[model samples]
Target: MRLSSKHVLVLSIASMAGHGAMAGQAESKGFIEDSHLDFMTRNLYWNHDYHSGHNNAQRTADRDRREWGQTFRLDFSSGFTQGLVGFGVDLSGYTVIKLDGGAGHSGQAGVLVPEGNSTAHEASSAGANLKVRVSETELKYGNNLRPYNPVFAPADARLTPATATGFWVVSNELKGLVAEAAHLTAAKDFNSTNLSDDFFAAYAGVASDTVDFLGASYSVTDQLSVSLYGAEYKDIWRQYYGNANYTYPLSDNQSLNFDANLYRTVDEGSSRAGDIDTTAYSLAAAYTWGAHTFKLTYQKIHGDQPFDYLGMGPGTFHDSIYLANSSQLVDFNGPNEKSWGAFYNLDMAAYGVPGLSFGARYIVGRDVDGSRMDADSPYNFYGSERSEDHWERDLEVKYVVQEGSAKGLSVRVRQATHRIGNGASDASADQVRLIVEYPWSIF
Candidate 1:
């Protein structure tokens, strides 16, 4: 089922009114009494290798990219003052030093920003936000906002996390419910030190002045929850999203979970991306028993253009798409595409090894046809492709220190391989990433 923006807004309001009782707010503590300061350091090594010998010959210039970087992040949040309306502030700073990125192996990957055919040696950025709260609602205006919802979310898959300049408001007035609204003007790319970069369409690369979204999530029961969200990409398109999740317990160590997500998009205003009308959805189910979990997912797209979302710059695909089939290397979001995935995860704690885990997933997509796109549409570039297919496989392992001075330190390794067919637009590649992180807190 599809819902319009007005319908979504009205539904959210109705849900809010239905929950009659208000969640009382706690008395505020003086500024600095409840404040927190945190510092974290991360070392990342990433390598991407595009396989040669594909029928497409245009993919030869730079087939391999490898980069290593270290990042230091500092974050501080001040406590609210004691009053009917409380005020607070949040500050964040980040610096990334390139450890390895020679001239031949630098750019195009999201690990580090390139500088004139080479990777930048170092980059840094800082931002702050002001916030006000009343009852169970809070409002924030800042350049360091990291909002995560169905409609919009920043990317943090690389050396640094992306930040946005925006005004955001969140209300938890009613128990088990969260309501949010935001107007974002710009973003800081994950690989760049620039503070404010224009927002663009992920696939079409069409620019937009701003993005506005409203969303709400409500828990109907301890095991069931639902969310609805709507957004407008300022003269580009209007998108709506809905999600439902439920979990059922079988025993002390066994459970079953189901999740479904849906999105509807249509052209609006100038339709800068051109005649977009699409519906994309995914359904996933998982069963967990003791130390192992097994999951299966199915996703589909119904439109002439590929399912796309927001981006900060060239090759900077944000984490805005919450589809189940979106994987480490590819989103599997081609036009008129259908995909399925299988995943498995294991925790070593059940086997006497604490703080260790492993995971693997594989996804395949087929029936990607973009031949129906309008001739003048920005997505026409994909019109030459029909009946394309692709697949990706990923494996991961991670370990964390559980005690002593090294507590809160973690190390992770991930590997992915993706392959595409003749008519597909994506390239076949193998990718590996090694990451180590340590964090500390100071009063």
Candidate 2:
């Protein structure tokens, strides 16, 4: 059945109303009596230094952009009204205030703040969702959502999170399995209130109204899970994704883990994205002993176009494209690119500090096909010479209050560096971020 965006919501509400009328009214009181609300405050300090890798005067001049900001986040989720089909609502909003950003660095200093001449000092956004549940299936319509699927996993790396106007349905009736269908109409960028269809377009650069996806995930055992998904950007491209994760205990204090992801994309309909066809894969393995863990990863892209995913924000949380080299500073993804990574993680609890943790990771990518880039691409200077290489290193430490009056307070420090050769897609930069957050329930 075809339905306009407005009709989608109307139909959902109608269904909920019909279901509520049939179910016993007394049971529906739970919707209001079991509601939940929370408020959280977060403070962030970020700094970045950019330099030239090839003496490009333009890229060289932008340096040392710094910004500080604070955010208040509010969320409320209502329990569903008891019925054959239950109804509920979710409300969320965020407000931010810029603390510092003394103009100089291209306003990109605060990647999460909408930039004015320097950077916006304040911004806020709010969203509400109406949801209907029948058995284990749920349908929702709204802006703020967290799907965690391969196609549209919105970014939360910034102060403001990505949001989209859309409708979705999910089912979890089957044990250890979830199935989903989503349609997104428009998206708001991470830092701005403005909605745009072209926000995440890069290849063909054409923006479309609706993006649709269907996916299913299954947890076969306590230590194994798998997912498969397919998506289409109307008039652009169609993509399929697959993922698997597994963990096994090796000994009393040791364990091993494995993860793999694969994606296939092809042009759809009129091929607005210009005959898109691409294949990408990522694989990782990890071993943990006591409070220490080590990991290795490999990633590769096979196609004319680079492996890319949808994101209204600047970037997704971790390896949005399922690539090992998607570091804090750069996603080492380019046409025909291949990358490898190594990482280590440590928990201070082993040494008596229960709420502290540290981590370090390094990724290197090569075989970038700069030659294949057309006018739509970034690096036109180099062609298939494929000599472009880039590497990134990231170090992070974090501490959280485990107990006491200040419990739930967390402090994190992150530093990273991206060094690139001549054919790289992005610039070389050094970044440092300090974030502190104290979350206490306001409900």
Candidate 3:
């Protein structure tokens, strides 16, 4: 059903009227409501270079660029109705106003697209989303950013793309069970005002014209959970995924967690590979003690090509970078490649500094060969290289104001340095990010 602006208003009024009538009769007349608002600003500095055999020969000497900019974001979510079949709405929106930098500094990076060539700066449309919900489920509509394993709409970068036009149903109707399904069209790549012209375009060896997916998750026990998912992109490929995670207590103050993810994909009708099949997998473990967490992950790609995703992946977290220490880069983990990551986090809040924390991680890639770059596919992060290796280190510190005028205000500082081994094109560089965020609640 198409709902014009007028119809939406009328329906909202009618819903309120019905609730009033019930209230007068002593029936549950009042619905609890809560309002949430969050705002954040970030200052970022980036420097990158493309070298021979890196990113497919996009070398820094030939196309080196550096960028610095600031980004602002606001988010809001509403509460539901009071009754058994409650109704509610949620909103996620943000705008990017370029502070300084342009295409000349073009890694294009994550936020704010250049207006002309790679030198002009332009403001991007504010990404926004609206969602309606029932008892324990939600029907999300409009452009929103989603960050999760698999199909993530990145929002972690200085500026990230916002996916447009999609509907999803998310439910937790049964104990320990969760399910979701969606159809998507149109995407606003981070920092650009225009949606991708290829939003639903299909390619023989590249993107699918449209993307459809369904997923379900179940918790078998407090310490274990499993998930299954399937997806199809017309004329491209069909993909399936399975994931499992379990937690085990090792001692009174420590625990061990294990996680595994696997994917199986096959080219379908009109796909570039006709009937080719591919697989990718990852395993990770973490041990946690009071105030400290140590983690390790091993990833592998076992096909003749890189994994394909809608636009790009790994933007689902506050700190995701392709092939980086923490970001989910599928490239380094692509066909015939193996990678490892080791990281640690410390929550100073547990010791004394409430809302203070620090963390660091190192990631290494090996046995990566890009000689098989998917012809004409820009999706490949590695250029035409026979073998590659690289490592990155990241450090971050954060603090949140606990009390006083600035109570709830949060600040974070992050730094990263990367050095590539032979056959990689990415530049050796350093990055620094500064961010401040706050939230307000209304009831």
Which one wins on lDDT? 1
Among all candidates shown, the one with the greatest TM-score = 1
- Each prediction's whole-model lDDT (CA): 0.83, 0.74, 0.59
* lDDT against true structure, model 3: 0.59
In model 2, state the lDDT of residue 246: 97
Scored against the true structure, residue 58 in model 1 reaches a CA lDDT of: 31
TM-score of 3: 0.77
Candidate 1 similarity to native, TM-score: 0.92
Q: Candidate 2: what lDDT?
A: 0.74
Clashing pairs in 2: 371-383, 371-384
Q: State the local distance difference test value for candidate 1.
A: 0.83
lDDT of 1 by residue, 232-315 (tens): 887888889999999999999999999999999998889999999999999999999999999999999999988889887755
lDDT of 2 by residue, 1-443 (tens): 87543454445444433432233333556787878898788888888888645324434555666778888889899988885767899998888888777465555554555533253678777888898877666788887666667876766666766677788877665678777777788877666666553335443345667777777899999999999988777777788999999999999999999999888988776765565578999899999999999999999888767776675533323224655556788766677889999999999999999999999999998888856556554334335556788889999999999999899999999999989876535678899999898888765
Worst 10 residues of 2 by lDDT: 17-26
**What CA RMSD would you report for each candidate?**
3.4, 4.3, 7.1
Q: Rank the candidate models, highest lDDT first.
A: 1, 2, 3
How much is 282 displaced in model 2, in angstroms?
A: 1.2
| Residue-level lDDT tens digits of model 3 in 1-443 | 97532343344333433332232123323333355666655556655444334443334433455666666566666555555444545555555555555455444554455322245554545545565544445566666646344643334555544455565666665678777766666555555556442332211224443556677789999999998877666576777888899999988879999988887778766764344356778888999998899999888777766555555322212211122223422235444678898989999877888889998888887777756767554435556677777777778899989998778777778877676777644455565666666654433
Residue 411's lDDT in candidate 2: 94
Q: CA lDDT of 56 in candidate 2? A: 42
